[model samples]
Target: MPKNGAPTRTRILDAAEALVIDHGYAATSVDDVIAASASSKGAFFHHFASKQALADALVERYVAADLEMLDSGLAAARAAGPDPAVRAVAFLDHFVGLADGLMGEQSGCLYAAVLTERQLLTSQTSAPIATAIRAWRDGFAALLREALPAGSPIDVDDLADHVFVTFEGAFLLARSTEDPSHLRRQLGVLRALVETALAAGPQEERR
Candidate 1:
Protein backbone atom coordinates (compact mmCIF):
# COMPACT_ATOMS: atom_id res chain seq x y z
CA MET A 1 0.00 0.00 0.00
CA PRO A 2 1.46 3.34 -1.03
CA LYS A 3 -0.13 6.78 -1.01
CA ASN A 4 -3.90 6.31 -0.80
CA GLY A 5 -3.59 2.90 -2.52
CA ALA A 6 -4.27 -0.34 -0.69
CA PRO A 7 -5.84 -2.42 -3.48
CA THR A 8 -2.53 -2.44 -5.31
CA ARG A 9 -3.45 -4.48 -8.40
CA THR A 10 -6.57 -2.57 -9.36
CA ARG A 11 -4.71 0.69 -8.89
CA ILE A 12 -1.97 -0.47 -11.24
CA LEU A 13 -4.44 -1.62 -13.88
CA ASP A 14 -6.41 1.63 -13.66
CA ALA A 15 -3.29 3.71 -14.15
CA ALA A 16 -2.02 1.42 -16.89
CA GLU A 17 -5.29 1.59 -18.78
CA ALA A 18 -5.24 5.36 -18.65
CA LEU A 19 -1.66 5.52 -19.89
CA VAL A 20 -2.39 3.03 -22.63
CA ILE A 21 -5.32 5.17 -23.74
CA ASP A 22 -3.39 8.43 -23.56
CA HIS A 23 -0.30 6.92 -25.16
CA GLY A 24 0.07 3.74 -27.12
CA TYR A 25 1.20 0.64 -25.26
CA ALA A 26 4.57 0.75 -26.99
CA ALA A 27 5.04 4.32 -25.85
CA THR A 28 3.98 3.75 -22.23
CA SER A 29 6.45 2.34 -19.73
CA VAL A 30 6.21 0.54 -16.36
CA ASP A 31 7.68 3.56 -14.65
CA ASP A 32 4.87 5.68 -16.06
CA VAL A 33 2.32 3.26 -14.64
CA ILE A 34 4.06 3.10 -11.25
CA ALA A 35 4.01 6.86 -11.06
CA ALA A 36 0.42 7.18 -12.22
CA SER A 37 -0.77 4.53 -9.82
CA ALA A 38 1.12 5.98 -6.86
CA SER A 39 2.52 2.49 -6.40
CA SER A 40 6.06 1.35 -5.76
CA LYS A 41 8.18 -0.77 -8.09
CA GLY A 42 7.98 -3.56 -5.54
CA ALA A 43 4.15 -3.49 -5.62
CA PHE A 44 4.12 -3.34 -9.41
CA PHE A 45 6.38 -6.37 -9.82
CA HIS A 46 4.62 -8.16 -6.99
CA HIS A 47 1.35 -8.22 -8.96
CA PHE A 48 2.83 -8.42 -12.45
CA ALA A 49 6.05 -10.29 -13.19
CA SER A 50 6.79 -8.05 -16.14
CA LYS A 51 5.30 -5.31 -18.29
CA GLN A 52 3.90 -7.97 -20.62
CA ALA A 53 2.10 -9.51 -17.69
CA LEU A 54 0.60 -6.14 -16.89
CA ALA A 55 -0.61 -5.89 -20.48
CA ASP A 56 -2.22 -9.30 -20.18
CA ALA A 57 -3.95 -8.32 -16.96
CA LEU A 58 -5.14 -5.07 -18.50
CA VAL A 59 -6.69 -6.94 -21.42
CA GLU A 60 -8.40 -9.42 -19.15
CA ARG A 61 -9.84 -6.68 -16.94
CA TYR A 62 -11.12 -4.66 -19.88
CA VAL A 63 -12.60 -7.70 -21.58
CA ALA A 64 -14.38 -8.82 -18.46
CA ALA A 65 -15.79 -5.33 -17.96
CA ASP A 66 -16.97 -5.25 -21.57
CA LEU A 67 -18.81 -8.52 -21.16
CA GLU A 68 -20.40 -7.33 -17.97
CA MET A 69 -21.56 -4.14 -19.65
CA LEU A 70 -23.01 -6.07 -22.57
CA ASP A 71 -24.92 -8.38 -20.31
CA SER A 72 -26.14 -5.65 -17.99
CA GLY A 73 -27.19 -3.41 -20.82
CA LEU A 74 -29.13 -6.30 -22.26
CA ALA A 75 -30.72 -6.80 -18.89
CA ALA A 76 -31.67 -3.17 -18.73
CA ALA A 77 -33.18 -3.40 -22.19
CA ARG A 78 -35.30 -6.37 -21.22
CA ALA A 79 -36.46 -4.64 -18.08
CA ALA A 80 -37.29 -1.44 -19.91
CA GLY A 81 -39.71 -3.07 -22.31
CA PRO A 82 -41.48 -6.28 -23.18
CA ASP A 83 -41.53 -6.00 -26.95
CA PRO A 84 -38.41 -7.08 -28.74
CA ALA A 85 -38.38 -3.96 -30.88
CA VAL A 86 -38.69 -1.72 -27.85
CA ARG A 87 -36.09 -3.78 -26.09
CA ALA A 88 -33.74 -3.28 -28.99
CA VAL A 89 -34.10 0.47 -28.76
CA ALA A 90 -33.86 0.27 -25.01
CA PHE A 91 -30.58 -1.58 -25.33
CA LEU A 92 -28.94 1.20 -27.30
CA ASP A 93 -30.67 3.79 -25.17
CA HIS A 94 -29.14 2.29 -22.08
CA PHE A 95 -25.71 2.99 -23.44
CA VAL A 96 -26.76 6.45 -24.54
CA GLY A 97 -27.49 7.31 -20.92
CA LEU A 98 -24.10 6.04 -19.85
CA ALA A 99 -22.24 7.62 -22.74
CA ASP A 100 -21.73 10.97 -21.05
CA GLY A 101 -20.36 9.49 -17.87
CA LEU A 102 -18.11 7.31 -19.97
CA MET A 103 -16.96 10.31 -21.92
CA GLY A 104 -16.32 12.31 -18.77
CA GLU A 105 -14.61 9.60 -16.73
CA GLN A 106 -12.63 7.86 -19.47
CA SER A 107 -12.47 9.52 -22.82
CA GLY A 108 -11.11 6.48 -24.68
CA CYS A 109 -11.74 2.80 -24.91
CA LEU A 110 -8.96 0.42 -23.88
CA TYR A 111 -10.02 -2.09 -26.52
CA ALA A 112 -9.58 0.45 -29.30
CA ALA A 113 -6.27 1.59 -27.82
CA VAL A 114 -4.95 -1.97 -27.70
CA LEU A 115 -6.32 -2.77 -31.15
CA THR A 116 -4.36 -0.03 -32.90
CA GLU A 117 -1.24 -1.41 -31.27
CA ARG A 118 -1.98 -5.04 -32.03
CA GLN A 119 1.64 -5.92 -32.31
CA LEU A 120 2.17 -4.88 -28.70
CA LEU A 121 0.18 -7.74 -27.27
CA THR A 122 0.88 -11.47 -27.44
CA SER A 123 -1.64 -13.83 -29.02
CA GLN A 124 -2.77 -14.92 -25.59
CA THR A 125 -3.66 -11.31 -24.83
CA SER A 126 -5.19 -10.62 -28.24
CA ALA A 127 -7.40 -13.72 -28.38
CA PRO A 128 -9.56 -12.66 -25.44
CA ILE A 129 -10.08 -9.25 -26.91
CA ALA A 130 -11.19 -10.83 -30.20
CA THR A 131 -13.43 -13.23 -28.36
CA ALA A 132 -14.98 -10.48 -26.23
CA ILE A 133 -15.63 -8.31 -29.27
CA ARG A 134 -17.26 -11.24 -31.05
CA ALA A 135 -19.25 -11.86 -27.92
CA TRP A 136 -20.63 -8.33 -28.26
CA ARG A 137 -21.43 -9.06 -31.92
CA ASP A 138 -23.22 -12.25 -31.00
CA GLY A 139 -25.05 -10.67 -28.10
CA PHE A 140 -26.35 -7.81 -30.19
CA ALA A 141 -27.18 -10.14 -33.05
CA ALA A 142 -29.32 -12.26 -30.79
CA LEU A 143 -31.15 -9.16 -29.57
CA LEU A 144 -31.60 -7.87 -33.12
CA ARG A 145 -32.96 -11.22 -34.20
CA GLU A 146 -35.61 -11.06 -31.53
CA ALA A 147 -36.48 -7.49 -32.52
CA LEU A 148 -36.66 -7.90 -36.28
CA PRO A 149 -39.59 -9.53 -38.01
CA ALA A 150 -39.26 -12.74 -39.95
CA GLY A 151 -37.77 -12.48 -43.46
CA SER A 152 -35.79 -9.41 -42.50
CA PRO A 153 -33.01 -8.93 -45.03
CA ILE A 154 -30.57 -7.35 -42.61
CA ASP A 155 -27.56 -9.40 -41.58
CA VAL A 156 -27.54 -9.12 -37.81
CA ASP A 157 -23.82 -9.75 -37.63
CA ASP A 158 -23.12 -6.84 -39.96
CA LEU A 159 -25.49 -4.62 -38.06
CA ALA A 160 -23.87 -5.74 -34.86
CA ASP A 161 -20.45 -4.77 -36.19
CA HIS A 162 -21.81 -1.38 -37.10
CA VAL A 163 -22.85 -0.92 -33.50
CA PHE A 164 -19.39 -1.91 -32.35
CA VAL A 165 -17.74 0.48 -34.76
CA THR A 166 -19.95 3.38 -33.75
CA PHE A 167 -19.27 2.78 -30.09
CA GLU A 168 -15.52 2.63 -30.58
CA GLY A 169 -15.44 5.55 -32.95
CA ALA A 170 -17.64 7.68 -30.71
CA PHE A 171 -15.12 7.51 -27.90
CA LEU A 172 -12.21 8.29 -30.17
CA LEU A 173 -14.00 11.19 -31.78
CA ALA A 174 -15.05 12.54 -28.41
CA ARG A 175 -11.57 12.23 -26.99
CA SER A 176 -9.99 13.89 -30.00
CA THR A 177 -12.41 16.78 -30.08
CA GLU A 178 -12.75 17.18 -26.31
CA ASP A 179 -16.49 16.90 -26.73
CA PRO A 180 -18.63 14.74 -24.48
CA SER A 181 -21.66 15.57 -26.59
CA HIS A 182 -20.04 13.74 -29.48
CA LEU A 183 -20.32 10.50 -27.61
CA ARG A 184 -23.91 11.18 -26.62
CA ARG A 185 -24.90 12.13 -30.14
CA GLN A 186 -23.17 9.16 -31.72
CA LEU A 187 -24.92 6.76 -29.35
CA GLY A 188 -28.18 8.54 -30.13
CA VAL A 189 -27.63 7.74 -33.80
CA LEU A 190 -27.22 4.08 -32.93
CA ARG A 191 -30.50 4.14 -31.06
CA ALA A 192 -32.17 5.73 -34.05
CA LEU A 193 -30.77 3.06 -36.34
CA VAL A 194 -32.19 0.32 -34.14
CA GLU A 195 -35.54 2.07 -34.13
CA THR A 196 -35.47 2.37 -37.91
CA ALA A 197 -34.87 -1.33 -38.36
CA LEU A 198 -37.53 -2.20 -35.85
CA ALA A 199 -40.01 0.18 -37.48
CA ALA A 200 -39.35 -1.20 -40.95
CA GLY A 201 -40.53 -4.70 -40.75
CA PRO A 202 -39.23 -7.37 -43.11
CA GLN A 203 -42.39 -7.19 -45.20
CA GLU A 204 -42.00 -3.44 -45.59
CA GLU A 205 -38.45 -3.88 -46.83
CA ARG A 206 -39.67 -6.03 -49.72
CA ARG A 207 -41.85 -3.14 -50.93
Candidate 2:
Protein backbone atom coordinates (compact mmCIF):
# COMPACT_ATOMS: atom_id res chain seq x y z
CA MET A 1 0.00 0.00 0.00
CA PRO A 2 1.15 3.52 -0.70
CA LYS A 3 1.91 5.68 2.30
CA ASN A 4 0.21 9.05 2.89
CA GLY A 5 -1.82 10.68 0.14
CA ALA A 6 0.94 9.59 -2.30
CA PRO A 7 3.99 7.62 -1.31
CA THR A 8 7.41 8.26 -2.75
CA ARG A 9 7.42 4.79 -4.30
CA THR A 10 4.07 5.31 -6.01
CA ARG A 11 5.29 8.62 -7.36
CA ILE A 12 8.40 6.94 -8.71
CA LEU A 13 6.41 4.21 -10.42
CA ASP A 14 3.99 6.70 -11.92
CA ALA A 15 6.87 8.73 -13.31
CA ALA A 16 8.48 5.63 -14.76
CA GLU A 17 5.26 4.43 -16.40
CA ALA A 18 4.65 7.75 -18.14
CA LEU A 19 8.28 8.10 -19.24
CA VAL A 20 8.48 4.54 -20.50
CA ILE A 21 5.37 5.08 -22.61
CA ASP A 22 6.76 8.26 -24.09
CA HIS A 23 10.40 7.19 -24.51
CA GLY A 24 10.67 3.40 -24.67
CA TYR A 25 11.78 1.48 -21.56
CA ALA A 26 15.39 1.19 -22.69
CA ALA A 27 15.70 4.93 -23.08
CA THR A 28 14.19 5.72 -19.66
CA SER A 29 16.94 5.73 -17.06
CA VAL A 30 16.72 5.57 -13.27
CA ASP A 31 18.00 9.11 -13.09
CA ASP A 32 15.18 10.19 -15.33
CA VAL A 33 12.63 8.56 -13.04
CA ILE A 34 14.19 10.02 -9.92
CA ALA A 35 14.11 13.49 -11.43
CA ALA A 36 10.57 13.18 -12.68
CA SER A 37 9.43 11.78 -9.38
CA ALA A 38 11.37 14.32 -7.34
CA SER A 39 12.91 11.65 -5.19
CA SER A 40 16.47 11.01 -4.09
CA LYS A 41 18.45 8.15 -5.55
CA GLY A 42 18.43 6.48 -2.15
CA ALA A 43 14.67 6.68 -1.91
CA PHE A 44 14.32 5.09 -5.35
CA PHE A 45 16.70 2.26 -4.49
CA HIS A 46 14.97 1.74 -1.17
CA HIS A 47 11.76 0.94 -3.04
CA PHE A 48 13.33 -1.03 -5.89
CA ALA A 49 16.44 -3.20 -5.76
CA SER A 50 17.30 -2.51 -9.40
CA LYS A 51 15.94 -1.03 -12.60
CA GLN A 52 14.60 -4.47 -13.56
CA ALA A 53 12.75 -4.66 -10.25
CA LEU A 54 11.19 -1.31 -10.92
CA ALA A 55 10.14 -2.41 -14.38
CA ASP A 56 8.53 -5.52 -12.94
CA ALA A 57 6.64 -3.48 -10.38
CA LEU A 58 5.46 -1.06 -13.06
CA VAL A 59 4.05 -3.84 -15.21
CA GLU A 60 2.41 -5.54 -12.25
CA ARG A 61 0.76 -2.35 -11.08
CA TYR A 62 -0.36 -1.42 -14.56
CA VAL A 63 -1.83 -4.84 -15.34
CA ALA A 64 -3.70 -4.98 -12.04
CA ALA A 65 -5.23 -1.54 -12.60
CA ASP A 66 -6.23 -2.43 -16.15
CA LEU A 67 -7.93 -5.62 -15.02
CA GLU A 68 -9.85 -3.74 -12.38
CA MET A 69 -11.10 -1.27 -14.97
CA LEU A 70 -12.14 -4.10 -17.27
CA ASP A 71 -13.95 -5.90 -14.48
CA SER A 72 -15.90 -2.76 -13.65
CA GLY A 73 -16.90 -2.42 -17.29
CA LEU A 74 -17.99 -6.03 -17.34
CA ALA A 75 -20.11 -5.50 -14.24
CA ALA A 76 -21.76 -2.53 -15.82
CA ALA A 77 -22.43 -4.52 -18.97
CA ARG A 78 -24.07 -7.29 -16.96
CA ALA A 79 -26.24 -4.79 -15.15
CA ALA A 80 -27.35 -3.26 -18.46
CA GLY A 81 -29.45 -6.27 -19.56
CA PRO A 82 -30.48 -9.87 -19.11
CA ASP A 83 -29.55 -10.97 -22.64
CA PRO A 84 -25.98 -12.31 -22.71
CA ALA A 85 -25.35 -11.13 -26.28
CA VAL A 86 -26.59 -7.66 -25.47
CA ARG A 87 -24.39 -7.56 -22.39
CA ALA A 88 -21.37 -8.65 -24.40
CA VAL A 89 -22.00 -6.02 -27.06
CA ALA A 90 -22.42 -3.44 -24.33
CA PHE A 91 -19.05 -4.45 -22.89
CA LEU A 92 -17.37 -4.03 -26.27
CA ASP A 93 -19.07 -0.67 -26.72
CA HIS A 94 -17.79 0.36 -23.30
CA PHE A 95 -14.28 -0.46 -24.43
CA VAL A 96 -14.79 1.58 -27.60
CA GLY A 97 -16.02 4.52 -25.58
CA LEU A 98 -12.95 4.36 -23.35
CA ALA A 99 -10.64 4.17 -26.36
CA ASP A 100 -12.40 7.10 -27.99
CA GLY A 101 -11.77 9.27 -24.94
CA LEU A 102 -8.07 8.47 -25.05
CA MET A 103 -7.84 9.76 -28.62
CA GLY A 104 -7.58 13.44 -27.81
CA GLU A 105 -4.61 12.81 -25.52
CA GLN A 106 -2.97 10.41 -28.01
CA SER A 107 -1.65 8.43 -25.03
CA GLY A 108 -0.66 5.00 -26.24
CA CYS A 109 -0.96 1.88 -24.08
CA LEU A 110 1.91 1.20 -21.68
CA TYR A 111 1.69 -2.56 -22.11
CA ALA A 112 1.84 -2.24 -25.91
CA ALA A 113 4.85 0.04 -25.63
CA VAL A 114 6.71 -2.35 -23.33
CA LEU A 115 5.88 -5.40 -25.43
CA THR A 116 7.26 -3.67 -28.50
CA GLU A 117 10.57 -3.26 -26.63
CA ARG A 118 10.50 -6.81 -25.29
CA GLN A 119 14.10 -7.36 -26.30
CA LEU A 120 15.18 -4.81 -23.74
CA LEU A 121 13.11 -6.36 -20.95
CA THR A 122 14.62 -8.82 -18.49
CA SER A 123 13.04 -12.22 -17.81
CA GLN A 124 11.53 -10.93 -14.56
CA THR A 125 9.91 -7.98 -16.30
CA SER A 126 8.77 -10.11 -19.23
CA ALA A 127 6.91 -12.59 -17.05
CA PRO A 128 4.34 -10.08 -15.82
CA ILE A 129 3.97 -8.70 -19.32
CA ALA A 130 3.07 -12.13 -20.66
CA THR A 131 0.71 -12.71 -17.72
CA ALA A 132 -1.03 -9.42 -18.41
CA ILE A 133 -1.61 -10.30 -22.05
CA ARG A 134 -2.91 -13.75 -21.20
CA ALA A 135 -5.19 -12.35 -18.50
CA TRP A 136 -6.75 -9.98 -21.01
CA ARG A 137 -7.24 -12.76 -23.57
CA ASP A 138 -8.72 -15.08 -20.99
CA GLY A 139 -11.03 -12.41 -19.63
CA PHE A 140 -12.40 -11.77 -23.08
CA ALA A 141 -12.74 -15.49 -23.73
CA ALA A 142 -14.78 -15.98 -20.57
CA LEU A 143 -17.08 -13.18 -21.60
CA LEU A 144 -17.56 -14.67 -25.07
CA ARG A 145 -18.27 -18.10 -23.61
CA GLU A 146 -21.09 -16.66 -21.52
CA ALA A 147 -22.38 -14.37 -24.25
CA LEU A 148 -22.37 -16.48 -27.41
CA PRO A 149 -25.33 -18.70 -28.19
CA ALA A 150 -24.82 -22.42 -27.51
CA GLY A 151 -23.45 -24.43 -30.48
CA SER A 152 -22.53 -21.26 -32.30
CA PRO A 153 -19.98 -21.81 -35.06
CA ILE A 154 -17.59 -19.20 -33.74
CA ASP A 155 -14.55 -20.30 -31.77
CA VAL A 156 -14.67 -18.36 -28.52
CA ASP A 157 -10.96 -18.68 -27.74
CA ASP A 158 -9.87 -17.74 -31.22
CA LEU A 159 -12.18 -14.75 -31.35
CA ALA A 160 -10.91 -13.61 -27.99
CA ASP A 161 -7.33 -13.77 -29.25
CA HIS A 162 -8.36 -11.96 -32.39
CA VAL A 163 -9.93 -9.17 -30.34
CA PHE A 164 -6.73 -8.70 -28.33
CA VAL A 165 -4.59 -8.74 -31.45
CA THR A 166 -6.84 -6.31 -33.22
CA PHE A 167 -6.75 -3.94 -30.28
CA GLU A 168 -2.94 -3.90 -30.24
CA GLY A 169 -2.79 -3.49 -34.00
CA ALA A 170 -5.32 -0.70 -33.89
CA PHE A 171 -3.27 1.16 -31.32
CA LEU A 172 -0.13 0.79 -33.40
CA LEU A 173 -1.87 2.01 -36.53
CA ALA A 174 -3.48 4.91 -34.75
CA ARG A 175 -0.17 6.00 -33.26
CA SER A 176 1.70 5.65 -36.55
CA THR A 177 -0.93 7.42 -38.63
CA GLU A 178 -1.47 10.20 -36.08
CA ASP A 179 -5.18 9.48 -36.34
CA PRO A 180 -7.20 8.19 -33.36
CA SER A 181 -10.09 7.20 -35.62
CA HIS A 182 -8.07 4.21 -36.76
CA LEU A 183 -8.75 2.55 -33.40
CA ARG A 184 -12.37 3.67 -33.25
CA ARG A 185 -12.97 2.33 -36.76
CA GLN A 186 -11.36 -0.99 -35.95
CA LEU A 187 -13.49 -1.35 -32.80
CA GLY A 188 -16.60 -0.48 -34.80
CA VAL A 189 -15.79 -3.34 -37.16
CA LEU A 190 -15.29 -5.70 -34.23
CA ARG A 191 -18.67 -4.73 -32.76
CA ALA A 192 -20.31 -5.27 -36.12
CA LEU A 193 -18.68 -8.69 -36.46
CA VAL A 194 -19.95 -9.71 -33.04
CA GLU A 195 -23.47 -8.54 -33.85
CA THR A 196 -23.38 -10.39 -37.17
CA ALA A 197 -22.22 -13.60 -35.51
CA LEU A 198 -24.92 -13.38 -32.84
CA ALA A 199 -27.54 -12.71 -35.50
CA ALA A 200 -26.42 -15.72 -37.57
CA GLY A 201 -27.17 -18.09 -34.67
CA PRO A 202 -25.85 -21.67 -34.61
CA GLN A 203 -26.53 -22.43 -38.27
CA GLU A 204 -23.69 -20.31 -39.62
CA GLU A 205 -20.74 -21.99 -41.27
CA ARG A 206 -17.73 -22.78 -39.04
CA ARG A 207 -15.37 -20.78 -41.22
Candidate 3:
Protein backbone atom coordinates (compact mmCIF):
# COMPACT_ATOMS: atom_id res chain seq x y z
CA MET A 1 0.00 0.00 0.00
CA PRO A 2 2.99 2.23 0.42
CA LYS A 3 4.35 4.31 -2.41
CA ASN A 4 7.79 2.99 -1.50
CA GLY A 5 6.48 -0.56 -1.83
CA ALA A 6 7.58 -1.31 1.71
CA PRO A 7 5.74 -3.22 4.42
CA THR A 8 4.77 0.19 5.73
CA ARG A 9 1.91 -0.77 7.97
CA THR A 10 3.82 -3.51 9.80
CA ARG A 11 6.92 -1.36 9.86
CA ILE A 12 4.98 1.53 11.37
CA LEU A 13 3.24 -0.58 13.99
CA ASP A 14 6.42 -2.39 14.86
CA ALA A 15 8.28 0.88 15.17
CA ALA A 16 5.52 2.34 17.32
CA GLU A 17 5.52 -0.70 19.56
CA ALA A 18 9.26 -0.54 20.17
CA LEU A 19 9.24 3.18 20.80
CA VAL A 20 6.28 2.95 23.13
CA ILE A 21 8.04 0.16 25.01
CA ASP A 22 11.15 2.28 25.46
CA HIS A 23 9.90 5.89 25.66
CA GLY A 24 6.30 5.12 26.59
CA TYR A 25 3.04 6.08 24.86
CA ALA A 26 2.69 9.71 25.89
CA ALA A 27 6.32 10.47 25.12
CA THR A 28 6.42 8.99 21.62
CA SER A 29 5.43 10.88 18.49
CA VAL A 30 4.24 10.17 14.94
CA ASP A 31 7.44 11.67 13.61
CA ASP A 32 9.39 9.30 15.79
CA VAL A 33 7.39 6.39 14.42
CA ILE A 34 7.92 7.60 10.88
CA ALA A 35 11.64 7.99 11.45
CA ALA A 36 11.98 4.61 13.09
CA SER A 37 9.76 2.91 10.49
CA ALA A 38 11.23 4.81 7.54
CA SER A 39 7.86 5.52 6.00
CA SER A 40 6.26 8.60 4.44
CA LYS A 41 3.13 10.41 5.57
CA GLY A 42 1.23 8.92 2.67
CA ALA A 43 2.24 5.45 3.78
CA PHE A 44 1.51 6.20 7.43
CA PHE A 45 -1.94 7.56 6.62
CA HIS A 46 -2.58 4.60 4.38
CA HIS A 47 -2.29 2.33 7.41
CA PHE A 48 -3.52 4.46 10.32
CA ALA A 49 -6.21 7.09 10.50
CA SER A 50 -4.36 9.05 13.15
CA LYS A 51 -1.75 8.80 15.89
CA GLN A 52 -4.39 7.53 18.32
CA ALA A 53 -5.50 4.86 15.89
CA LEU A 54 -1.90 3.76 15.45
CA ALA A 55 -1.47 3.66 19.23
CA ASP A 56 -4.54 1.51 19.56
CA ALA A 57 -3.13 -0.94 17.04
CA LEU A 58 0.24 -0.93 18.77
CA VAL A 59 -1.31 -1.58 22.17
CA GLU A 60 -3.39 -4.44 20.79
CA ARG A 61 -0.32 -5.99 19.24
CA TYR A 62 1.65 -5.52 22.44
CA VAL A 63 -1.07 -7.11 24.55
CA ALA A 64 -1.43 -10.08 22.22
CA ALA A 65 2.30 -10.74 22.23
CA ASP A 66 2.44 -10.38 26.00
CA LEU A 67 -0.44 -12.75 26.61
CA GLU A 68 1.15 -15.33 24.35
CA MET A 69 4.40 -15.14 26.30
CA LEU A 70 2.61 -15.42 29.64
CA ASP A 71 0.56 -18.36 28.44
CA SER A 72 3.69 -20.09 27.15
CA GLY A 73 5.56 -19.44 30.38
CA LEU A 74 2.72 -20.74 32.54
CA ALA A 75 2.40 -23.80 30.34
CA ALA A 76 6.11 -24.44 30.59
CA ALA A 77 6.02 -24.03 34.35
CA ARG A 78 3.11 -26.44 34.72
CA ALA A 79 4.80 -28.92 32.42
CA ALA A 80 7.95 -28.74 34.54
CA GLY A 81 6.33 -29.92 37.77
CA PRO A 82 3.89 -32.54 39.05
CA ASP A 83 2.07 -30.86 41.93
CA PRO A 84 -0.51 -28.25 41.07
CA ALA A 85 0.71 -25.95 43.84
CA VAL A 86 4.28 -26.40 42.73
CA ARG A 87 3.29 -25.66 39.17
CA ALA A 88 1.60 -22.44 40.20
CA VAL A 89 4.65 -21.36 42.10
CA ALA A 90 6.85 -22.20 39.17
CA PHE A 91 4.64 -20.15 36.89
CA LEU A 92 4.75 -17.17 39.22
CA ASP A 93 8.52 -17.52 39.45
CA HIS A 94 8.81 -17.58 35.68
CA PHE A 95 6.66 -14.45 35.50
CA VAL A 96 8.91 -12.71 38.00
CA GLY A 97 11.97 -13.63 35.99
CA LEU A 98 10.30 -12.31 32.88
CA ALA A 99 9.54 -8.99 34.57
CA ASP A 100 13.12 -8.61 35.68
CA GLY A 101 14.52 -9.42 32.29
CA LEU A 102 12.18 -7.21 30.29
CA MET A 103 11.99 -4.10 32.40
CA GLY A 104 15.26 -4.20 34.36
CA GLU A 105 16.07 -0.64 35.45
CA GLN A 106 13.35 0.78 33.23
CA SER A 107 10.31 2.31 34.84
CA GLY A 108 6.60 1.80 34.01
CA CYS A 109 4.42 -1.08 32.83
CA LEU A 110 2.81 -1.39 29.41
CA TYR A 111 -0.66 -1.87 30.86
CA ALA A 112 -0.18 0.82 33.45
CA ALA A 113 1.16 3.07 30.74
CA VAL A 114 -1.86 2.54 28.55
CA LEU A 115 -4.18 3.26 31.44
CA THR A 116 -2.27 6.38 32.35
CA GLU A 117 -1.96 7.63 28.81
CA ARG A 118 -5.65 7.20 28.06
CA GLN A 119 -6.16 10.86 28.82
CA LEU A 120 -4.08 11.78 25.80
CA LEU A 121 -6.71 10.42 23.44
CA THR A 122 -10.48 10.45 23.14
CA SER A 123 -12.79 8.00 24.90
CA GLN A 124 -13.00 5.82 21.81
CA THR A 125 -9.28 5.18 21.98
CA SER A 126 -9.57 3.77 25.50
CA ALA A 127 -11.74 0.77 24.69
CA PRO A 128 -8.98 -1.38 23.28
CA ILE A 129 -6.65 -0.60 26.18
CA ALA A 130 -9.30 -1.49 28.71
CA THR A 131 -10.14 -4.64 26.82
CA ALA A 132 -6.50 -5.62 26.73
CA ILE A 133 -6.16 -5.22 30.49
CA ARG A 134 -9.33 -7.19 31.13
CA ALA A 135 -8.19 -9.96 28.84
CA TRP A 136 -4.89 -10.12 30.69
CA ARG A 137 -6.64 -10.40 34.03
CA ASP A 138 -8.96 -13.07 32.71
CA GLY A 139 -6.05 -14.98 31.30
CA PHE A 140 -4.36 -14.98 34.69
CA ALA A 141 -7.56 -16.17 36.31
CA ALA A 142 -7.84 -18.99 33.81
CA LEU A 143 -4.29 -20.05 34.54
CA LEU A 144 -5.05 -20.21 38.24
CA ARG A 145 -8.17 -22.26 37.57
CA GLU A 146 -6.09 -24.73 35.61
CA ALA A 147 -3.33 -24.86 38.24
CA LEU A 148 -5.69 -25.40 41.17
CA PRO A 149 -6.04 -28.83 42.69
CA ALA A 150 -8.91 -31.01 41.59
CA GLY A 151 -12.08 -30.32 43.67
CA SER A 152 -10.42 -27.39 45.36
CA PRO A 153 -12.99 -24.83 46.49
CA ILE A 154 -10.75 -21.83 46.06
CA ASP A 155 -12.23 -19.01 44.00
CA VAL A 156 -9.64 -19.13 41.27
CA ASP A 157 -10.88 -15.84 39.85
CA ASP A 158 -10.38 -13.91 43.09
CA LEU A 159 -7.04 -15.52 43.75
CA ALA A 160 -5.91 -14.66 40.25
CA ASP A 161 -6.99 -11.04 40.70
CA HIS A 162 -5.01 -10.82 43.92
CA VAL A 163 -1.98 -12.36 42.26
CA PHE A 164 -2.22 -10.01 39.29
CA VAL A 165 -2.46 -6.94 41.50
CA THR A 166 0.41 -8.09 43.69
CA PHE A 167 2.57 -8.93 40.71
CA GLU A 168 1.88 -5.61 39.02
CA GLY A 169 2.66 -3.64 42.18
CA ALA A 170 5.84 -5.61 42.79
CA PHE A 171 7.08 -4.91 39.27
CA LEU A 172 6.32 -1.22 39.74
CA LEU A 173 8.18 -1.21 43.04
CA ALA A 174 11.22 -2.95 41.57
CA ARG A 175 11.38 -0.46 38.75
CA SER A 176 10.98 2.47 41.11
CA THR A 177 13.58 1.35 43.62
CA GLU A 178 16.03 -0.11 41.14
CA ASP A 179 16.22 -3.04 43.57
CA PRO A 180 15.52 -6.49 42.20
CA SER A 181 15.36 -7.91 45.73
CA HIS A 182 12.00 -6.19 46.19
CA LEU A 183 10.57 -8.27 43.40
CA ARG A 184 12.18 -11.41 44.86
CA ARG A 185 10.47 -10.78 48.16
CA GLN A 186 7.16 -10.24 46.42
CA LEU A 187 7.58 -13.49 44.49
CA GLY A 188 8.42 -15.22 47.78
CA VAL A 189 5.14 -13.94 49.17
CA LEU A 190 3.27 -15.45 46.19
CA ARG A 191 5.09 -18.76 46.70
CA ALA A 192 4.08 -18.70 50.32
CA LEU A 193 0.49 -18.05 49.32
CA VAL A 194 0.50 -21.02 46.94
CA GLU A 195 2.07 -23.20 49.61
CA THR A 196 -0.61 -22.15 52.05
CA ALA A 197 -3.36 -22.88 49.54
CA LEU A 198 -1.90 -26.28 48.92
CA ALA A 199 -1.70 -26.88 52.66
CA ALA A 200 -5.51 -26.75 52.79
CA GLY A 201 -5.38 -30.26 51.31
CA PRO A 202 -8.02 -31.87 49.09
CA GLN A 203 -10.91 -31.21 51.47
CA GLU A 204 -10.33 -27.52 52.25
CA GLU A 205 -11.25 -24.38 50.39
CA ARG A 206 -9.88 -20.83 50.28
CA ARG A 207 -10.82 -18.74 53.29
Which residue runs of candidate 2 sit more than 4 Å off their true CA positions? 1-5, 103-106, 118-122, 203-207
Evaluate model 1: give its TM-score. 0.92
Ranking the candidates on lDDT from highest down gives 1, 2, 3
For lDDT, the strongest prediction is: 1
Encode model 2's per-residue lDDT on 1-207: one tens digit a residue. 334468888999988988988788889999999998888999999999998888889888988987787686677678878887888788778877877776665457777767767664546666666776677678777778888777787888788776667677887888788888877788888989988877666775558
Over 4 Å off, model 1: 1-3, 203-207
Candidate 1 residue-wise lDDT, 1-207, digit = tens: 466645989989999999998887889999999999988999999999998899889999999998999998889878976788887788888888888787778868888878777575545677788898898898888889898878778888999887689888888788778887887798798888877887785655435
lDDT of 1: 0.84
* Each candidate: RMSD: 2.0, 3.5, 4.9
Evaluated at residue 126, the lDDT of candidate 2 is 64
The whole-model lDDT of each prediction reads 0.84, 0.79, 0.70
Candidate number with the higher lDDT (2 or 3): 2
Question: 14-124, model 3: which lDDT tens digit per residue?
Answer: 777778756778799888998888888888888899888887786777667767776776686668777655666777777666656655544445666666675544546
